[model samples]
Target: MKIFRLTFFLVLISQLALAQTKRNIDHQSLTWIRYYNILPLTEKWALHSEIDNRNFIDPICQNVFVLRVQGRYRANKNIDLGGGFAYFNANTQNPNNNPDYSVPEYRLQQDVTLINDIAKITFHNRFQVEERFIQKANATELLDDYSYAWRFRYRLQATFTLWEKEKQSLKGSISDEVMFNLGKDNTKNTFDQNRIYGALRYAFNPNIHLELGYLKSFQRRASGIDFYDRDIVRFTVYHKINRKTKA
Candidate 1:
């Protein structure tokens, strides 16, 4: 009788342990892919490529690559609207003794601009959203634990034209952006990031221009476990695809 009771207790404990392990394995694993195209109704669109890298305090590394297309449309003498999408991929090396990991993401954004000719001032506001999917390793059945995650961002910018010629102009702008995260998984804490950017643009012609800029970025994770701060510089070439009618 005593032996039977001990055996029954051990079996019950094993079952409870198995149940707890199953409940804790709630991490979602999915693969994500994205594509972006910038098309304008009137003008020729510009093509741009971007690369970003991050180095963590733990010496872990991650990198991202982006390709973008963008075009502008005039709403009136003082306003314009632009929209674009981006394909982004991020890869991170394992900190522990394991294989590397990668996450592929897709994002889209649109903007509206208000211009003042007399003051040579422009107010540009933009909204953007992004979604990410996770990838799983071989030998594991893909789980529907987590399917999708999203983020929203807003930006405000002010620009001033410094010089103008018959076919060329030099301009400078400053901008600030804020980001928020909205998703189904409650595990991710509030995702917030801020950026300050400054850029110089040179118009070679009415439809062609080039831009160079530097960005300062700061990021905070909701869980309060990880924080990233960094600076990046970018060089971009832009072209106006369509001709603008005189106002």
Candidate 2:
């Protein structure tokens, strides 16, 4: 028993050490807020829209803003399909002491989600593909206006009830997502990013749900070959509108 405990602790320490390598690790604190609104047009069709705001807390830098719109179709009880367009505007933080520049990115995305229930816990698996157009720098100007990449992403999530007596109940969840780039424009690294998160959720009378979470994100830098290790506090609000069926 003593040897087993020591081995387990050593393994954890090694994992943390591997995550904080010497290759440009930025230990950053982030605050993220998101709103998701789902409005149902029919029993089989819905409109999904979301907005996200992310900020770095220590130096008070505005990180990114994302706006997403999707059309969702419920194919069956266990499957959902969606196609979406997303716009991203991000602060680049010019290192040359020039004016702070903005990078704009646009994406077309398609996704499918599968859900299952086992032993009172629900599992969600999502697979997505994206075609991204990111603004780059030209030889003469600061912005080149067009660069393309293809990315693939997958996420797995599990949710279970914390406590439930009557109409009010608390739920908890954990999720992990991994992203990979697969385009000729992406040369240095094919591995893009990873996110791991855990959250507590509350449903306020079924029309609105609130989630508060802690997230750890690791990503390679866009313009350069550096990396970032970020710790994030995430808050999200979900509002359901014009619902004809249970979601």
Candidate 3:
């Protein structure tokens, strides 16, 4: 417990220091909601789907929204493979000066989980990789938006139970994710952004869980010269379902 709290403070202090070195810092509050589910289709196959919505707090604007679906194959108890398609739309505060973007993205992803127990405390370490294709725009005689850029993402997360009673449990977690651009047009900013989140998770049962957390996102602007710093309030719900076999 002491170590976790100390690490949390260290992360916050680093973020603040980084904020001071950016070209421009925009402090925006975000309200984010997400729903995730996994439904078993067979012994080794499952369906995964998620919906995410984010709102800007200052002027009550819709900042971003996403809907995604994936077909997953459980390789083993510790690993999973998935391929999915996602629809993403993001609105900029100053559209006239910034790019208005919408992308139909496809991704191949992998998930790995590791668990360790020590001194009556259990820890979960989750690692994930994602390959992304984001659509691009054309300004020539043809107005096609099918041109795409590739990006790769990696995330690492750690969670530990803080308390438990009967069917309910409380947990704390911290995660960091980094994104890299893989194309020349998008390569000016080889490093896209970094996201850091600290959250409290509550498990209602074996199949249902909820998380409420604070997220700090540092993003490089499209011009590749400035940055945007966002403070977010995130809430997410998760559910899992198993397939029933006929006897």
Candidate 4:
């Protein structure tokens, strides 16, 4: 009986060890180039247009391309409401990697931004929601269906004036954003990703500025056990038209 019990315990231990899963993590480096334009239509309304291209570092491959358009309404001095439509072209090494097909994603986004000013520093709090539709593929990696996912994102950004002139300024910015997924199928990895970013912004005039930034991103893959840690270099151009000086 002692020998039999010993055998049983060893078998159970081996079975238990095989049940545990290992985590997979990939590290990547990338770059993003972006353009953003803001056009004011009236005293309290504006339009936003943006485009971005993201690429990989070592072999120089495109990871993703983005186009976004948003409409904003200024509710008051401290509040704004915005809604937008975005299209994303996903490549081989996107945030969610699929080596099979270059998929297309359509997204709808809505957000509210709160602004506060203290001395020469400005703080922006943004809460955003997204409805995402990602094109799906079949067993052989052929386009077969579309999947729906919902996500919520929150971002806190601060901008500070380092030096100022009448028409131009030098500024610094820092922001952190966290994203979460929601749905019945996403139970294991509801926590999607987080990004930490910082930048130096130089304004040539009231209507034009350039920003150079860096970002670190941590993301959980669809399997829930795999992760991607990425470092990114970012360059952006900010443009404005039709200023609302009095309003």
Which prediction has the highest TM-score against the true structure?
Answer: 4
Error at 223, model 4, angstroms: 0.8
The TM-scores of all predictions, comma-separated, are: 0.62, 0.84, 0.75, 0.85
Backbone clash pairs for candidate 3 read: none
Candidate number that wins on TM-score, 1 or 3: 3
Query: Candidate 4, which segments miss by more than 4 Å at Cα?
Result: 1-22, 94-100, 138-140, 243-247
The sequence of per-residue lDDT tens digits that candidate 3 reaches over residues 43-121 is: 8788889999988887777777888888877676656567777776655543233344543555555555455566664
lDDT of 1 at 169: 97
Candidate 2 C-alpha lDDT tens digits along 74-149: 8988999999999998764322222446678999999999978989998888889999998886433457558899
- Prediction RMSDs, each to the true structure: 16.1, 6.1, 5.4, 11.2
lDDT of 1: 0.54
Tens digits of per-residue lDDT, candidate 1, 1-247, equal 2433443454456445434542221111121122322224443233333333333224444345555554556767667666666555545422332234455555665666555444677766565555544433333343434345676666667889999989889999998776766765424434456677898988898666777777777555545344446555555555444634333
What number of backbone clashes does candidate 4 have, counting pairs of residues 3 or more apart or in separate chains? 0
Q: lDDT of each model, Cα atoms only?
A: 0.54, 0.80, 0.70, 0.84
For model 4, what is the error of residue 140's alpha carbon versus the real structure, in angstroms, after optimal superposition? 5.2
Model 4, TM vs. native: 0.85
State in Å the error of residue 9, model 1. 58
Give the alpha carbon lDDT tens digit for every residue of 66-173 in model 4: 999999999999999999999998886644444666779999999999888988779888889999998886535747678888998878789999999999899999
Candidate 3, which ten residues in sequence have the lowest lDDT sum?
138-147
**Model 4, C-alpha of 88: deviation from truth (Å):** 0.5
